[model samples]
Target: MKKETGRPTQLITRKFAKELHSNFMKYRASIIAKYIKKEDANAVWFSVEELENYIHYIKSKGEKTGYDVNGIRIYFGVYPEQRKYAEKAGLMTVFLQATGKKIRKAAKEGEVQTLALVMDNGDGDISSIEPMNYGSIGRPPSLLY
Candidate 1:
């Protein structure tokens, strides 16, 4: 009788297991990146109240640092749960409520030029820009989107 060639059932060593685990992690990261990009491209504008709730949600979900960029206080690196909540809330409502006062002030001052709405993945990567303007042209950039 001839011996049959079959798959070996053996335990993987620690080094190999670690490498495999690392590869899986990288793959997961890539998937997350793609999802973030898609979400960013489809990001909506949120209100001040919504934004505040989102910030709170982010804090609850394990966000540690908040970034202040060009007068825009951005809360990033929120946990998956927080991000999901924000997404469910949508951009239009959340951001609009969050920055309602600012938007109103800009309108009153006639300094609102454009509003750029953006969303990011938890991994330090951003996706898109949704721009909204108050007037037709030549307005100063006093808006933070």
Candidate 2:
């Protein structure tokens, strides 16, 4: 099958990952730490299964849009700064967005369709959706389409 014009998956080297992870740690401690919970001031990670299943769900839900389900938008997000949402208050995170062409093609249709794979708005908890990993960051950069 032919591919469509959209995001492309990217791969990074372990050396590069290490450098990036180091940068993240520095940046988090210097800037993001104060705004978020102490425990949350590290990394936000999603397992391979979690991501793959979400992609499957997105494709299934969109149901053969012909737009080609081969891209995604990972948006930087922040938990609302409120007492009620204290566990995630002002925390920085990323959202893995729509991969279905129906959702991606919305850009061409004058409006963009977004599907943030967060628990409040996705199916199957997406592997617990936001299981923030409190560890080092950086990995081979994967630009999935």
Candidate 3:
């Protein structure tokens, strides 16, 4: 079979999308209720358009910085109460990618870091690509709610 070089739309699935959204709502409801005002309605998920645009931007920016551009780490975030946006304390997404050599070194050194990266074993098996889900905090731009 010929390897299709373009992005694979065949991989998309509505079933999982709905399931993940439902799961997020189920698990995240309390946190949203506590952190965001009732009117704020913290978002359960982000639109694909927003996510795709951000991914494209990451790829472009990563190439400019001369990195192999292996991955993007999306962190969950919220605007603080003092934030002027309507999404204050609402869901936000922070996109992190391989920026510079310094970040890679920090990951390798295993030092205590809030700003840190984890490099895969140099053996080339990217086991991290396996299905797993998680998030961390950040400030808001596009609110999830």
Model 1 Cα lDDT, one tens digit per residue, 1-145: 9879787688788888777656644664346546754332112235666555555544433222332112123332222444555433221111211111111112324457754434232332111222221111112211212
lDDT of 2 at 4: 79
Rank by lDDT (best first): 2, 3, 1
126, model 3: CA deviation in Å?
A: 17
Model 1: residues >4 Å from true position, as ranges? 1-8, 33-145
- Which 10 residues in a row give candidate 1 its minimum summed lDDT? 96-105
lDDT of 2 by residue, 6-100 (tens): 76478787788888877766665555555543534345667787777777765665454333344466666666779985455666557665542
Inter-residue clash pairs, candidate 2? 9-143, 10-143, 70-145, 71-145
**How high is the CA lDDT of each candidate model?**
0.34, 0.50, 0.45
Worst-scoring 10-residue span by lDDT in model 3? 125-134
Name model 2 segments beyond 4 Å from true. 1-9, 27-29, 34-40, 64-67, 100-145
lDDT of 1: 0.34
* lDDT score, candidate 2: 0.50
